[model samples]
Target: MTDGQITLTGIRAHANHGVLASERELGQTFSVDVSLDVDMDTVCDDLTHAVNYALVAQRVLDVLMGEPVNLIETLAGRIADAVLAISPRISSVQVTVHKPHAPVGVALDDVAVTCRKDAE
Candidate 1:
């Protein structure tokens, strides 16, 4: 990460997304963390040059709250794409999504997936 690189992290409320009937009816909350790597040299003169964590968080919330997804993986992908679309300065992105209330039979703490991408 560079000197002024930034990361955005938060938990979002999402609808249930599983083949199971019960999961479909009830929604749950999922946690998401996004790391954005950017070249801040151009924006060094102004704070705006740096990635705004608040904007990132709001964007993530918009995706999660606006759309109904079948899987957290898809949500993560959409988020990563959204971030890159919004900030061309972002050179790379790492997104991690956590589902704490997965419908697993056995006792488990949480389920999560991480995706790393380089800007095109």
Candidate 2:
């Protein structure tokens, strides 16, 4: 596989994912960034030869909008796994999950976790 990369950033979804009960009751927005290491040889004029990014985004959104996890780290890993499962052409994936309104009770721009997964 050639060292080709594709990225989808700023994928936003609203969900109940946090350590607080209030968070689960009142969901917040989460932003995901995904980076994929793929086989450049598969890149061709035909859409079938390449990974469809729209589907990837939907998959990420599904994960983000599906379950409630306490940590952003878990959310990141789940997103990575989901993205990698999209196609064998994707060798590895990096996922970053951002939680803007964390319950840390402090002023912060954002809180996030990043995780990477490689094909087995």
**Candidate 2's TM-score:** 0.94
Give the number of the best model, judged by lDDT.
Answer: 2
Question: Residue by residue across 28-98, what tens digits does model 2's lDDT show?
Answer: 99999999998866545787888888999999999999889988898898888888889998999999898
Q: Which ten residues in a row have the lowest lDDT in candidate 1?
A: 1-10
List pairs with backbone clashes in candidate 2.
none
Clash pairs for candidate 1? none
lDDT of 1 by residue, 1-120 (tens): 254467777656676655567767787777888898887765356656667768888887778776666777887888888888777778888888888888878889899988887789
Q: What TM-score, computed on C-alpha atoms, does each candidate reach?
A: 0.84, 0.94
Candidate maximizing TM-score: 2
